[model samples]
Target chain A: MHISSTEVDYIALGASSDFRADGRHAFEFRDVIVESHLVPSVSGSSRAQVGGTDVLVYVKAELGPAQGKNGTEGVITFTAHYSSVTGLDNEVRTSNMLNAELEESLNRLFSEKQAANLERLCLLEGRVAWTLLVDVTVLKADGNVLDVASFAVRNALLSTLVPHVEVIRGEEGEADEIEVDDEPASRRLLLEGDPPVFISVCLLGSKWMLDASQDEEASMTSKLSVGVNSSGKVCGIVKAGEGALEWDGLGDTLKTAANMGVKIIEGLRKVQASRAETVGFFA
Target chain B: MGLREFDYGPLVSVERGTEVTTRERKRQWNELRPLFMRTRMVSHAAGSSYLEAENSKVICSVNGPLANTGGRTEAIERAKISCYISRTKFCGLEDDELEKRATTEYEGIVCRALESIVRVEQYPKSTIEVHVLVIEDDGSTLSAAITCACLALADAKIELRELMACCSVVNANGQLLLDPTLDEEKEASGSVLVSYLATSGKVSTVFQTGQLAYDEMAQAVELTISGAREIAVLVRNCLRQRESKDRGL
Candidate 1:
């Protein structure tokens, strides 16, 4: 839904009074719960629930030959799907749009060059590389699904452990291979350069609200979802609703989103650090 | 005059000497009224609402005022309207005979009611989609559906020339009951579904099933129109409340 221009003014005024319908301060973040290693069968999985929005992400990495012109190195790809249990209109289309946005953001965040630099992800040069598949599901939607999904994906990837591979040659020109280890070992991805996180902010009444509820979403004049990194860098942006934003408000919203993105990234890092041992689906 | 009552667990067998009592029926009707009333259910969608009458619960969501598909976009004279009804698992998740019949009946009522009030010529070929999801069922499912759909369209903030509303009437013994709940539905001899444009007091659509006298049909229609008017008043008040809140008055 598009936000109307008048609604934008209303929200701006409402923010000044600190009288949000959901009773939250303009900059206050919602309660977020993140659980990692939820899917045991998959290499890694995590679920994050923020308010009424629930997102689940599963990561599976396999060693295979890298495709395309750059065959000499390794590659990593991410795919996402959106499905709805409730029969809301345009659910499929909305899910598809979110999936495409996430895929593009992840690809841009972790390019082919970065994957090769990660070392552990690449196996036997161009012949074999680890292709990571990240599947995200939105079970219940209240608001701010993009942020919850991003957090789940990042934590799932952190909990993932790729198997070790070794290539050995026989004495008489016969090729041979040996198992280095059966147990999986912990590993970390090179995420310092681009830790993209998404923030969905809505313009209501006359103020821009961060993490709106379902009711607030209906009343919003316009909404802007911006993807940013730990360094306050924007990776992508999506705008919807019937409202217009002035240059000043847009700029302020972006700044607020960037700051919120950094806090989210820091929170995720702490979650990863606190885990002593991996928890599987049952746990 | 009393509440309508019927057993939802199992159908009772009636013998020559055993007949359903009027007092028992009124008792059931009184029990079901609260479930049929709902106010401002959906937060998203331009307009949204849900109502539970007896055992039936339906939620309606409206989305539109955006770009329409195809070459018809040029004929910006009137808006297009489309209605879809989905019955969820709580209302018996199986694809059975009763579900199909209920959907077909509700869809017809919605199409007719919306077409009557919507300015179809305004947007030429574009369409405004109205989706209704039935989450639970007790009885009078289709009537509840029509009411919910109209409320949703209103919630979506769509411009409607007139407000629409619907209700179901059932013939039990010699009397007609308004908004029959799930239990009353099981014992009802027949049912009539009706939708009305409240502003003009015009009957947009009507459907009846089972045997009924000619006078009964007229009475049922009258009851439905009156019930619809009551619902319309509630919807208007809710919208006004929301507007007042937005204006900070």
Candidate 2:
């Protein structure tokens, strides 16, 4: 759809009334359906869909030997690939641009101190650590995909179960030996800490809606993705798109983001509970 | 997702009577790898094509006839052609640095072959950007990329002096192999790459290295051109089908 000037006006007008073309409220989120442990070869994996957007998240943990001054810290790497299946509008150039932005945003969202606690992932303090490799693939395209991708990644990481490794030696003139436990269920990760959920709020005209669909994204100017954990603390906030936010409008947006983030986290937790009771569609 | 490895079967033994069966269809020793070609796969690119041969796949996208470079306009009377090939990390073969070098090498090969065929003189001071990503690399990756990029340019409807395609050959010991798989490639004594333009039947580019006898080199070159001829037919079919489909739509 070539968004003409009149359609832009109509979108703005609709947002002012807190109504979208899909009849969603200004802050109501699209239903997110997630299937975890789909890619069994990986440590953990999930395929998530929100509206038309679909993303596959895969998380693999590797034992990383300590390096440099930050030997005690673990690492997290985010790599995003866009399949040509991202619908009609995403050409290679646009896809590349979106890919670079997604990588940076995801890296910022999980690699920093405010986001995930890497220290917990460290195995031997300064000697060894578990480096989590998070790969997100866009299987489909819709607006608000970045937000949905973060959700899928969070779920995948939560379900990831690493092998319990025991380190012995470096004392009594013996070399160190790191051995992984044979038990499959050992070392379940406690992801409920600071690994937050991201909520993307799209600012159209007089309204900022949560989880904007592809149609809703056309006229929206600014998009603010806020990451918040269950403790109700803000972790990261990234503002993108061509739109800007005024000082007063920014605070109100943050407040809305914080409230919606909690709701999303709660919703995701309930899904996790149900998943434990039975094998998902993909086992 | 995790550590991914491809089974290359067994390497072609030099003592195996100069002929070995491939993993796919039971064809002659001179047979080409399986080819699947399609264009206009990318919605955003001016023209796009995806090519898969055996285990190797490359996606190519063309984005120009776009105006002038960032700055510094060299007074060339032809379109400034550039290529950037990225070997995606998830293929899970080599490390980051090695994969980066492989990408750069393929990008150079692709640029050279395409520059020879693209009608660059028609769009002076403009640029036609060709970007290729290797989804998988079994063997002959550069040849696959060059072939894929040329298909994309044709798909974009760029005026071309001649339509082009490519083929790779390897000389394993005394035996010559067409479209060698990764296992065959590793055990080969030398490799040859040849790109051809359909109209002229002329060699647009030929890349050869490693120790080889004069006759071996000549025979490999001939085999590559003939192999590329087969691939060129596939490219033509892809472009024709896409054109008819667009008109239908």
Number of the top-ranking candidate, with lDDT as the measure: 2
DockQ of each: 0.01, 0.01
What is the per-residue lDDT of model 1 for residues A1-283, given as tens digits with 9 covering 90 to 100? 3345567466556666777766788777888899987777887789999987888888787766754334554555666555655223453335344456555544434432322244445555556566777777777767677677877877777777655455665468765443444445434332333346677788766678788876567676566666666666554444454333442225666678778988988888788778635456743
DockQ of 1: 0.01
Model 1 docking category? incorrect
Badly placed stretches (over 4 Å) of model 2 are: A88-94, A185-187, A190-192, A274-283, B1-249
Q: Give the TM-score of candidate 2.
A: 0.52
Q: Write the per-residue lDDT of candidate 2 for residues A8-80, one digit (tens) a residue.
A: 8888889988878888888888788988989878888888899999999999988887532467777888888
lDDT (C-alpha, whole model) for all candidates: 0.62, 0.72
- TM-scores of the models, in the order given: 0.48, 0.52
